[model samples]
Target chain A: MAVRTPTGSPSGRALGLGAAAALLLLVGCCTVGLSMELQGTVSLEGRLFPQASAYQGQEDYDASLVLEPELYWEGEGGLSCSLKPFLRLDTSDPERSHSDLREANLLYGADSWQLLFGLDKVFWGVTEFVHLVDIVNQTDLVESPDQEEKLGQPMLALSLEQEWGTLEAYLLPLFRERTFPGSRGRLRGPLVIDSGAAEYESGAGRTHPDLALRYSHTLGNLDLGLYQFFGTSREPLFLPSAGQEEELIPFYSQISQTGLDLQLVEGQWLWKLEALQRSGQGPGRGAVACGFEYTWVRPWQLDLDLGFIAEYVRDQRRLADDSPYDNDLMLGMRLGLNDAQGSELLLGMVQDLAQPSCFMVLEAGQRLGESLHLSLSGYLFVRTAEQDPLRFYQQDSYLLFKGSYYF
Target chain B: MKRSLMLLLLLALMPVSPLQALAETPEEQGHAIAVEADRRSSGFGDCTADTVMILRNREGQENRRQLRSRVLEQEDDGDKSLTLFDSPGDVRGTILLTFSHKRGDDDQWLFLPALKRVKRISAANKSGAFMGSEFAFEDLGSRELEKYGHRYLGSESLDGRECFVLEQIPLDSKNSGYSRIISWLDTTTYRLIREEYFDQKQRLLKTLFCREYQQYLGFLWKAHRLEMVNHQNGKETDLLFANYRFQVGLTDRDFRKNRLKNLRTGGGR
Candidate 1:
């Protein structure tokens, strides 16, 4: 990850920046999918975005560079995409190659879905209720700096989507450790559909074709939802050769989970409740969540959301004696800084009732320019009461700023 | 001990006072959800106010103020009008343009002051910034629900109340920004609490949070604060409501461009 410090080799850095920009443009072009216009022409506009920021706190005051040159051409065929590659030079790590291809995806639209493939970024979303539904995918698999650039492991991937009732079902094929790594996605694409509706899954994995569906509705002013996740995974419960030991959970991917959500709103007052069956990523327990919020009441864009989750994760026979990890609670808020619509700050609190641990997060961000966004988002992970020794004294802090552009 | 007993009673009554759920088939639910959304997803309800733009520089500090706005509604008669930025009363006008997945180019508009000339602002740069903000013509338009179709997803309990879930899929890609959006409507009242926006690739791009509810005109429910968080990036957007006076007294004449310059002259009132 090179921080793009324009020192003795300015031309060399420029060339690197230009090439990265070109790739970003290419990814953008591909994002538009195929052309739809019968008689179409095109026009283009782009820029070389460069930014610099300094990070403080637990670390030295080292400056980091941001170089994002983008190319954006929205064609007359009703197709358009923006590609923005980046070059970050962390002066702290001077000679390192911190440059990465970012948002290097083509945004293409088919009938029911849009596709973002390449070294891109994919975010599922946090619950509107507790803002803690951070499961399903990795929030860390960024298309930003200090992140890898494959394709589908997600450096490369293809997605299919369809809508039914208050639900949206999608299929994503990520070529990662579960599947063959490099070059696998280029040769094959994911083709999946929701299974017989007999089970809540789409039938795990592309091998047998899997599907994922999410439904969202509203009660009064609250949002409600039901979702199903299914897939076929071949990764054995334990890969001895890989030095993994322990019986792998059974029927993990086949029946990821199915759940419901409810959302309500009254004037500056909002609330949400979510009940879900454990998906493959968890202990396969059924969790019920209920939360409420208040807004516009006090100052600082005040908002509060609280949640309670009940689950039966262990000992099926004693489903009644469930633990608090089976239960979760989260609180979150947002505060505005400027009059600009997209300028604001955020704060959050989360708890695993069973584990008796929590995290409080305070993050703020601002739009400096078209592509330059400055945000210092971090959190304090705390252990309220824990038997695990490692939980005694632990904290991880991150200071990140991003400069992005669409080609 | 008496207070504790009373608190316990309140908690016992909580789940007992079940919220009334709205019963509607998928099609019926779709219609209800799309109705108001057909207007626009804008956070502003109704208000009487003035706006002035204070331009700033790279330092991000507002050093100047020039642009102005004034509103007037609820006429003596039934019809209402609005006068924007009234300086030269007779020489004023206002224009509104919607840009999105339309047939041709971006919608246009124009307002003439003298004689209250109201003209269409013809095809201009839809990509240009709006009010000095990063938002462009495409970002400011109303997301017409007519452009898409909705499917009712049933109900789930949000907070303590059940909610009707509807999935809105764009029938025409030309009409919106996201590929599909899932809307959560309160079961008792059809108010949206949360909305998930997906990109063309079916990726969850952002989540829209609506809070600070307010009751207006008895039947209508609204959110005074709205926030949209970009899931892909750390950046977020917020719309804060202030001095919202809906259905007060606004006349079409008051909206004339000629009244724009006369905003300081109380043309709005």
Candidate 2:
């Protein structure tokens, strides 16, 4: 059928030219040897809403439409290459756009000495809710509109998923894209310190590129994450629009966090916990935000996400008078749809007043057919303000609609 | 994926050159050599297609079913046999699966669920689509190998291994797709390693390759990866056997008339 792309007029032309060039280059290369693959998907979400706050509500419709490259791989002569570019849109807000370019590199994986040079997901950690898709330390959710490059967030990393354990290292040329690339955007359920970029400097007072050690080590069922974001903390990568400076605030030269992520599963119960500590970056901002969530599968998936945040968030910024002691709690339920296919639908609600007040969301996604899918969702801003609301009930809401394909 | 595999490879690959003349054509010794070569090469197992497949349409949705492969049966030329099920309630009484070696005729019968009576599946409509899939009724049969003949065409290395090559052709006209079939069977157990099937027009239309063979139950053989590539449609099917079990004491008693309906009632729920 017909597909709707997920980029504005400016990038639409650029993306088309680039994707077409990639496709042609791949097709032409087939003359020399085996063919390289091209896979993509486009996810789209459209929502009609009346209120806007950084906080997402459980029932608020965060409807989105997406389109990603259809991904495929061909094996011949021991060398394999995978090419993918993901583009998605939320007609909900152009400012809240997302996209990515990924060529999970080329590899000559034989009996041993397997190495990869492309962009791929580097799975690390075992924290259930957050770690289930913890393959890459780069960007996952591309929320913002302006993206800097194709292969959106590129990383030259190598990994050995060995029998004993796994070892990995990445050259995150741009660290900002590592932490808050702002593209994969953020969902309301929980908080993951997205991606951070390392900034560099010049002796003449110019800002060069910085580096970071975004690595992970596995010890049995436990994983340790060591991330040191070394950059002129305030050196911005992209120019801000209008009142965007506050949202993209930068203060110092470096901020690093070390944490232990654990995953343990017994029978139908799964437990995930993370303990983190941040330090040496100026003032009160260096604190810890950790939580543990346990989920059960047999009877049905009922997940409870309780977070504890003790922080005086650093050197310089404040839009409104905020508190250092913020504790948020969220509960969610996932109902299984089809056992043959293991399809499911989810419902969740949370009260994290410290971050962006109180919000509730109701979202449902189902595999429509063999190749098509559909989702219906909406969200509500239950209550906002560090102090409890006087009325305790009035709230604004937004509803969303989404559909996708895998062919 | 599963449809085309049975389509191009099953009958269309039948060898037809057995009618060729060789030496004296004495009682047609090497005359139809191509047809003889075809049968002598592929599908040489003492196999039986006791396929007990049930087509399911989505519940309450016009023609859709929740096709829960409720029952399966395996039989060899020997007394060894087996039949399995998702439930015992159905095969308890009545069910009938008919196999007509003839090309265009095949039928099935079952005492359906909700309706406790005998029913017949149309045999004449062999080419009609099954569950709107590419597979036709004629394709699901254990057409006796003797029904077709084969001849050896010597040996050659294929995909890096030396194999015994043969060609085959169906004895009857109204049977399968191949004007003739060329096959490379492994010298060991006569298992099909690679086969090239030609259409009625004598053009190579498809190829079937079997790999990663493992012996199951001393009698049953398994091909972990069976690939059927279509020359017409740019799509290829790779059937990966993640799990398979054969001859676990299943019997004809499991393939009764009453069992079909019993299993369908709650087959996939």
Interface RMSD of each: 18.9, 22.0
Judging by TM-score against the true structure, name the best candidate.
Answer: 2
Question: Candidate 1 docking category?
Answer: incorrect
Candidate 2: regions farther than 4 A off:
A1-29, A35-44, A50-65, A89-99, A102-104, A110-113, A121-151, A161-163, A175-253, A284-326, A339-343, A353-356, A386-396, B1-269
Error of 2 at A343 (Å): 5.0
Once fitted onto the true fold, the runs of candidate 1 whose alpha carbons sit more than 4 angstroms away are A1-72, A82-137, A141-169, A177-209, A215-224, A232-255, A279-284, A297-326, A339-343, A351-356, A366-374, A382-407, B1-269
In model 1, the number of clashes is 121
**DockQ of model 1 vs. true complex:** 0.03
What range of 10 consecutive residues in model 2 chain A has the weakest lDDT sum?
A311-320
- Deviation (Å) of A294 in candidate 1: 2.1
For model 1 the local lDDT of residue B139 reads 40
Model 1: per-residue Cα lDDT at residue A105: 44
